[model samples]
Every structure is written in C-alpha cells, then in structure tokens.
Target: MRIVVADDSFLLREGLQLLLAEAGHDVVASVADGPAFVAAMREHRPDVGIVDVRMPPSHTDEGLRAAVDVRREWPAARLMVLSQYVEVSYAEELLAAGEGGVGYLLKDRVSDLDDFLAGLSAVAQGGTALDPLVVRQLMARRPDPLAGLTPREREVLALMAEGRSNTAIAAAMVVTPGAVEKHTQRIFAKLGLLAGDDAAHRRVLAVVRYLRAAGG
Candidate 1:
C-alpha cells in the first residue's frame, strides 16, 4: 500500500518511513508540518496517511485539523492519527466524521509493530481502529452514563468503541459471534441508538453515544 507520514519530530518521521518501507509498503511522502502534510495528501493521494496529532508551529492539534480537512475533501481518504496523550476530545472529533477509514492510536502503542500495521491496514481497508487505552480512558471518565449497562454489555460496548468487528469482539470475549451480536443489540437498545440496516452507520452512532456519555 502507498502511504504518507506527517510529524514534526524528524526522528519519528524518519523512523516511520523506515519501518513502513521495510514492511513492504511504499512511503510516498514524509512531511513535517500540517500544511505540508495536506499538500502531500493532495499530491500523493496515498492509500493511507499516518500523522501525529501535534505538529510544527503551535504543536497543538495542527496535524489533526489537517487530517479532518483532508477527510472532508476526500471522504475516502484513510488516516491514522497518533498522539502521545490520550485525548478523548480529539478522538471524538476524528470519529465524528463517521464510520470506516479512520484510526486514533496513542504513540506508545506503535511499539507493537504488528498491531500498528494491523490498524493501518484496517483503516486503509475502510474500517475503524481505535486504541484500547483511549477506550479505557473514556470509560473511566463517566461512570454514571453507563450505569444502566450490565458488566457483559459494558465489555461488549468497550470493544465496539475500540472499533472491533463482531467476529473480532467475539474472539476477544471468548464467545460466539451470535452471542456477540446479541450483546451488541442490547448495547444499542440501552444506549437508545436506532436500529438500522447499515450496521456500520449504527456502529458509529453507538461509538458517538459512548464518547458523549464519557464526557468527551
């Protein structure tokens, strides 16, 4: 897959280029700041863009804003945002764009190269990939919002918020896909999310509700 990387830190940018290149993915562009990142996106139109949430100048959400702009201009654009901190608001803003072709992961998670690549691939393939730590942080913030959920339902919901598919969640929870589906239905029911034919859309709505309830 063709990829573009954007980060203000020269070391991290070079490291990412090397890592992706060694992994057999083409690093079409590597940029340092948000504007340059946006330009690279327009020029390369890569299969996926990996970017740091903070970059250049103010170093406060510039890369994230650029990512959002690119998504608006090209809804099919796939992006994975990396951040040093677990910023739930940033995650919410990125996910608010809707389902698929998006990811939000903490920089520390990159040490697990296999997981990182998996998330990048998932985003490239029009799927969601959220960091587990981000989900955990959000869950810890608003206990009252989820008080109505059973423990099992909360587990399913947390996995769902992490952008896992039913099959993946089922495997993680050590249950059948059918059981996972039942838990998902219960989650939506309790959260008051409307049932619909478009499962992906409903999934996004569920995640948004989860974030909002968590005070994000």
Candidate 2:
C-alpha cells in the first residue's frame, strides 16, 4: 500500500519510512505537522496514511482530525493513528468515522513487527484494528449515549452542535418537524443538557467535549 507518515519527530518519521519501505509499501510522503500532512496527502494521493495523534500547533487532535477530514472527502483512503500514550479517547474518535479500514495503536506496539504489520494489512484491506490496551480502557465504561438512538437522532446531534434550531435540525435529520423537536428534547435530556440556560454560548466547551471527553 502506498502510505504517508505525519509526525513531528524526525527520527520516528524517517524510521517509519524505512520500516514500511522494508515491508514493500511505498512511503509517498513524510510530513512534520498537521497542515503539511494535509498538503502532502493532496499532493501524493497515498492509499493509506499513518499519523501521530498529537503533532504540531496544539499537539491536540490535529492529526486525528485531519485524517477524518480526508476520510470524509476520500472515502476509500485508509487511516491509522499512532500515539505513544495508551489513550482510549483518541481510539474512540478514530473508530467513530467507521470501523472498516481504520486503526489506532500505541507507538510501543510497533516494536512487534509481525503484529504491527498485521494491523497495517488489516487497514489496507478495509478491516479494523485497535491496540489491546485501547480496547481495555474503552471496556471500563458503562452506558453509551449513542446506543439505542435512531439513525436520524444521531445525525441530528451531529449537526445540532452547529447551533441549529429545531427547524434546521429537523431539515438536517430528514424527519418531520415535530419529530426533530422530540428528538432534540430526547438528546438534550440524555446528554444532560439544559435549555433556556444560555448553554448555546458554550460552543467551544462543546467542541472540546466532543473532541476530548473520555466516554462522554
């Protein structure tokens, strides 16, 4: 599979290129930051991308997010996010896009060449892979807010945070206007949200919650 690497560390960047090359995969581009990663992907059009979760600028979820944007526009591309720390939250977002053709693993797991290669192969072939450590952390959580919701409800909330009103959310969710109102009420109650409280002004807080909350 043709691949691209995005990591701020030069050693890790170069090492990955050499290792993937040794495995007979082309390393089309190597970038040191999130913006550069995006540009490289557009320039090279690699089949798969390997990126560190925290790279450059905020050192937050830039890499993971860029991958998501790429996936939205290029549905066929495979993505794998690597991080040194065993963080469950990152894994959740990486898998949130879709289970197929995606992966999230701790960087330490790369030491096991056979196993690491297996993960790359899985993603390249439209399969899913998650580091065991990540799975363990995720299992510790009980209750999923997303569970048991109608597909329309899920889509509603996805755009709801964009500050859409009941009518707008209704249009986006493709349900009856009355149904959208009911679904929003259900979502607000389920998510512990309160209305008439100026919570709408907390959009940034909501963004971080969507991006950083552990099992939220």
Candidate 3:
C-alpha cells in the first residue's frame, strides 16, 4: 500500500516511514505538521495515512483536525490516527468523519508490529480498526445502548467495535464461529440495524452508535 506518515516528532515520522517501507508498503510522503500532512495527502494521494493525534504549535488535535479536513475534501481518503492515550472524543471525531477507511489506535500498540500492521491493512481496505482500549473506554462511558444485549452479545459487540471478523471474535471468545454469528444477529436486532443491510456497514454503524455518546 502507498502511505504517508504525519507527526511532529521527527523520530516517529521517520520510524513509521521505515517501518512501513520494511513491511513492503510505500511511504509516499512524510511530514511534520497538520498543514504539511494535508499538503502531502493532496500531493501523494496515498492509500492510507498514519497521523499523530497531537502535533506542532498546539500539540492538541491538529493532526486529527487535519485528518477530518482531508476526509471532508476527499471523502475516499483513508487515515489511521495514533494517540498516546485513550481520547474518546478524538476517536469520535475521526470515526464520525467517514463511513469507513478510518482507524484510531494507541501509540503503544505500534510495538506489537503484527497487530499494528494488520490494523493498518484493515483501514486501507475500507474497514474500521479501532484500538481495543478505545473500544473498552467507550463501552465504560455508555451502558444505555447496551441495555438490551446479553453479556455474550456485549462481548461480541466489543470485538466487532475493534474491527474483528467473526472468526477473530470467535477465537478471542473461545467460541464457535456459528455462535458468534448468532450473537451478532441478535446484536443487530437489538440495535435496530436492518437485517437486509450490508453486514459490514451494520457493523460500523453499531460501533458509531457506541461512540456517538462520547461527544456528549
């Protein structure tokens, strides 16, 4: 995949460039701040971009704001935002900006190279890849939407929010794939997601609803 690395830290920017290159992906552009990130996105039009949540001058939400701007100008642009901590509001804004092709991962996760690469790949393929910690924090913030779900179904929903596939959810929960499917179906029903809707779309909608209250 073609990509861009955006962060105020020179080390992080270069680290990501090198990491992506080693993974056999092209790092088309690397920039230091939000404005430069936006310009690089326009110039390179990479498949996905890796952006830090805080950058430059303010060190608060500039990169994320620029990501939102990119999505606004080019709806198809994909981005994976890395934050040092669990910033639910930032995740809300990033996810709310587009239907898919967006990710919010903690910086710590980068050390787990395999997981980080998988998350990046997921986002590039037009799928959501939310950090597990972010999902857990969001769940703790809001229990109202989950009132109708059973305990098992809730676990399923949490994994779904992490952008896990049914097989993955099953493995994580030590359950059968069919069991996971049933739980997901019930989650859809309780969430009022149309049964006829695209499965992937419904999954993203469910996660979006879960985070929607975070902004409030």
True lDDT of residue 87, candidate 3: 66
| Model 3, residue pairs in steric clash | none
Q: Write the per-residue lDDT of candidate 1 for residues 1-216, one digit (tens) a residue.
A: 999999999999999999998999999999999999899999999999999989879988889888988887877788999998866666656666745688889998899999899889878977777898887776677664778789898888788877788999999989999999998888888877778646666676677677667764
Give lDDT per model, in order. Answer: 0.84, 0.68, 0.85
RMSD of 1: 2.9
Ranking by lDDT: 3, 1, 2
Lowest summed lDDT over 10 consecutive residues: which window, candidate 3?
207-216
For candidate 2, what is the TM-score? 0.62
Model 3 segments beyond 4 Å from truth? 213-216
Candidate number with the higher TM-score (1 or 2): 1
lDDT minimum window of 10 residues, candidate 1: 90-99
| Global lDDT of model 2 | 0.68
Query: In candidate 2, where is summed lDDT lowest over 10 consecutive residues?
Result: 203-212
Evaluate model 1: give its lDDT. 0.84
Best by TM-score: 3
